[model samples]
Target: MQQQAPKAYIIVSNDKNEIQKTSAYTAKTLSSIIKTCLGPRAMQKMVLTKINSIEMSNDGNSILREMDVNHPSARCLIELSRTQDEECGDGTTSVLIFASELLNQIVPHLKTLHPIKVCNILRKAKDICINHLNTIAMEAAESDLINIVTSSVATKLCCVLKLPIPELALRSVQLIKSSIDGRIDVKNDIKIEKILGNFDECEIIEGIILEKEIIHSQMRRSIENPKILILDMPLEYRKGESVTNMEFSNKNDFTRALEIEEEQIHKMCGYIVDTGADIVITEKGISDLALSILYEKQITAIRRIKKSDSNRISKATGATVLNRLEDASPKHLGEAGMFEYVKIGKEYFCKLSKCKNPKAISVILRGPTRDVLTEIERNFMDAVKVARNVLLNPKLVPGGGASEMSMALKLNNSNDKEEKIIFRECGVALKVIPSILSTNSGNGICLDVINELEKKQNKDGPYFGINGITGEISDMKNIVLEPLVVKTQCIKSGFEAVMQILRVDGIIESKSK
Candidate 1:
């Protein structure tokens, strides 16, 4: 019999030797990478790319996505931050810090405690933390919510993408606060566009604008009280899927075939003109022949808009997208108050206005460079997302680590003997966030600040926390605020990810034959 070869594997099976070798190392590794991006004073990292370009970002996901991480356990923590960003849009780094600290506490206890027991204890502690968080949450004032958005934007852009953006975020939240169905749906209702100009020139348009230009220069540039038509099918003759070859015996047959195609195009144009539509926006191309007729009839025709733009046009103008030319009936036609074309520099924008109670709106952003514009767009997205979440939850939490300190104080003082260690550990774990905030802010005596803040939370109230700037504890509720959903989601997502990493003992890799 041939001797069996040894199977290569890593053992982390809740045992001391493996726990330190595998799980603890992963928690420490991931936390070290993302902890620098936690608070307002967190330092920005300059990521050197493969192409030798340098990019700077303080966003947790943006920084994590650029990292060179290979450990499986470390990757699970990355997923935790990603989920937090998707669900809460902010506080991603806080989630990672909380999870890492929780894992750090559980390592020594793994000798006597079963992984399942720890998980159960964490679940209970999470509920306790969440309850305390809700208790401290306050009704959001409109100004407070605006501050939340602005603060989040400032963190992402270092106060460079400020000014009208914060104000724009405020107005946008109000406009998209309540959907027709009375639910939070700002992501769908908002549209963004980038054009060439100064950032100061950017403004919100109450209606949709197509990037497409007029196909015929002879067509009228402005039409008032315009009837808008949205078309999905081509405004020209298209051959069917099956291939067919026609043999023309003489020149007349070929000429007649050409006539037939032109006649079809003309018929399509005539149908559009008969409908009294001032503008025809199509998802497919419009033949030159059709354009000629439409131009002669003084109708504005824009060809080949994206499907997403087409849908918005329908919502704004109430136009039904037709599958066939025959569907262009009065009942199918949509109306808008005004339709016109505007030229900015060399670009043409199809601007629509006076759509009664238009639901979709676009905020055009401009910058001097492509990179500047790209960063501006991302910053705006983060701001808008926070605002939308506030509308949905309608609860505000004190920022500057106030909520964490308060929750930590609450969970540590719990009297449950059975899970006392777990609860206290979770409470202690919460302190790492504020500590990291102080350290990242360049405070060498950061631990002293955390102790002072925790003491203040106990004496003064849950609202007092250290200001990252001055290292002095203050009323965070009055000075700093954040959406309540971000804090709750960080806890909910962080605990689940920590459990998943802890439960893993051995990493088995198989080799293919």
Candidate 2:
């Protein structure tokens, strides 16, 4: 019998050409996967997770997040989108698109030029393009902020819900900005609460809203100018340790023990009542006996509240969270102008409002269904982030690819020939934004629209691009605007990702036995 050749247990390939080919293919493939999910007219991708749940979204970061790709290059691109979202929060899709196109642009030139040379050229081009973008960027005014928010929200929401959503988002961001003492942190300060209801009924509350009800049925549901008490300790009777045991010789002995427990709980409730707290919120449980005492005193008690919610309530109402009943005092109490138990959907929520100084606020997001509400929340979050970015940076760029196209044109016109070739490719890569926008519009005149945009920018001197909705060339200055930080991050992050992918030289695989 012929000797059978042993199967290759491990394979290693250091072929530079094959590795570069793989990287390019992976980047382009990943790009094409989300290409249709780019613009206002983009298509939505329905991702079915391993746990068998479905997520339908057009947001690039969301789509890539749910994908379970094993390819290294694909993961890098996905991580790039995540980083963009974390840093800028609004240009996740644009960064990925630009990065892929940049790779696509420079891949062909790799055979003629060194990878390090290409990387350096692209790096220099990125800096120059960004500086040019900065020169063209205009400062954002108060009204212009709403426009920027509207532009971002308009892409994800329907026309009917567009107008009000941005208003709510900007208002929430402003509330967070104004309330904070030193720093403005939108992510932690703003709380988004979603309830199933009419979408048009969405509103922002000036204080926290907890999805919890009063512990006792007889407790008051509404109070005016209530003093609040927040607790970190349990109001229930303490339990004996596992190592300790108690034996009762008679049933009356056990009854005496129960009475002592009730008396202890009553004394704890008396501490709160003495503090003149109209409402009590605890991070731990409250026993039935304690609830009865609070109810008799007409105090509304919310038990088992989340720690984060308790902290926010403290911030909103100027209350101090106490770990012991002995530490309760009038000075430790917080005051709210109004406290009410509101029934939303099939559940009851505790609403605290009209605080004198509230550093945290709740945005109530309502929709006809869970999926709709989820999508709205996702889109609203991006809008909030966009508003925050603008408030922090206060700079604006013409949206709908005008800024990108202008950067592309300027990058191409650089004086040095060697640098000119690199800039030309970079410029062409930047044009992918408008080209994809045109393609997704289904106008069937992508090339025509691109040429028209270039002509308009060349003639009108920037601030001219295709209107994503109408698929026609228009003055983007009056039509739409995006934050300068978002655009700047897109080019910087995209180029970095392309450089990472292009620098890969080989892959070594070892199969497990």
Candidate 3:
């Protein structure tokens, strides 16, 4: 018989004998990168991009997304990181680190057992983990909505603070929520209007709002009794009446047609006057006759609005024009009279309000510098997103280190009849539970402590070893666990992600070979 090509066993295989032996290596490397950033003591990573320069953050998702990865196995871990980012926005590092440890712990057993058998065990264990998580989750007490908001804000404090323990994070959360009497979404709907001179004079409003800037660069510093004109129609000349073939060469006929065009412009100006418009915003350039009429009325005019500068106005003030004004009255303009001009760079502000929606909310965050402000804004927005989800769902479980411990404990005690055989064959897999807890604690001494616990419980029921050492699941009924809520959401998010990943099995092969 011809000698067979050297055979090798690997966990994941692709054609051409390209074995995937790096999952273990990739998981270890990824875990080490994120382990240091665990808990409140975490520090930020300053990432430099090609054009944007740098971003400073300790956030796992930000770090993972910013980092360039080439290894296929590492990319899989990155996908898990993305899943965590999308679900909770925070705890991405925690999720990835936990997953890494879970995969690492299972590697040693792969030597004596088939990869498929390992996978089956893991599948059973994951199901038990989820079921136990559900039980522990039900045991968790309902969290106060206020506490949930406060806790979310607290987690973001490290990223938000400039001098470490900056007080504004708490105060901002309180201020944002104060208007709605603790209702999170209602508080978010409240907008900060503007700072009247200093921070003390800051005002908040509640309604649709916009921050408009001046239209013309040369407009006066301020116009007294400014006429406000709003129009929806174009200012170009209407189609001239079709000229007859004989009239094409006749200069006299051309002159008569020009006069008719001027008359149409005059008619448009008459309509503006009829509507009592003081300032005109038009879709097209004003005809000379219309311009003259506007000057006579002392009505300021801005042209080519949708094209000329609508984007800047929209971004600055967040106001959107719904319709063109036909006949506008002073009172109908509401606060439109309060237009004020302020200059920044080459831009001038002419704040206008149609009195349609009056409320404007501004979130003024105080930090050391502009970069800090940007980072704080990102953190605040992420927190706000998570807070909104909590408000909608209101159910939470332990997350981070706490979640890992809870799940391990639950799995040790989980008494599902169908899994008893696999549980026995696995030979006290629960013995590994304490090790999982120790890995997350980031303390070698804690690992020693867990090892001691495991030694004492080896004689107990097959799955009782981890339970004995890690201690029984206490009644979490009275205590409010903020991370738990985030954790539960994250697990559900992870399950959804895994299901999606499982839907596509095996990578597509290139036909070029």
Question: Using Cα atoms with residue i matched to residue i, what is each candidate's TM-score against the true structure?
Answer: 0.91, 0.91, 0.61
Candidate RMSDs in order: 3.5, 4.0, 9.2
Clashing pairs in 1: 12-505
Could you say which candidate leads in lDDT?
Answer: 2
Compared with the true structure, what per-residue lDDT tens digits does model 3 show for residues 1-513? 565565443334553212223555676797777665554445457788546668777667777777787665567778777876665555576566655555555545444555555455556666766665565453322435445444444435433442222233223333334234544432334332222222222222222223344344444444443445444565657653786343457768878877888877776777667655455655556666666666776566666664323332322233333244344444333224334455422344344433223233334444444555556655655565555455445565532233444455445553665344344433233323344444444445555655555443343311222221223322223223444445655544443332233233244433321
What is the TM-score (0 to 1) of candidate 2? Answer: 0.91
Better of 1 and 2 by lDDT: 2
Tens digit of per-residue lDDT, candidate 2, span 114-205:
88988888888888889998999999988788878888766675433553878888888777775335456777777789899887778888
Candidate 2's C-alpha runs over 4 A off are 1-14, 158-163, 178-182, 239-242, 245-263, 413-417, 509-512
In candidate 1, which residue ranges exceed 4 Å CA deviation? 1-21, 50-52, 184-188, 247-251, 335-340, 343-347, 416-418, 442-444, 511-513
- Which has the higher TM-score value, candidate number 1 or candidate number 3? 1
lDDT of each: 0.78, 0.84, 0.48
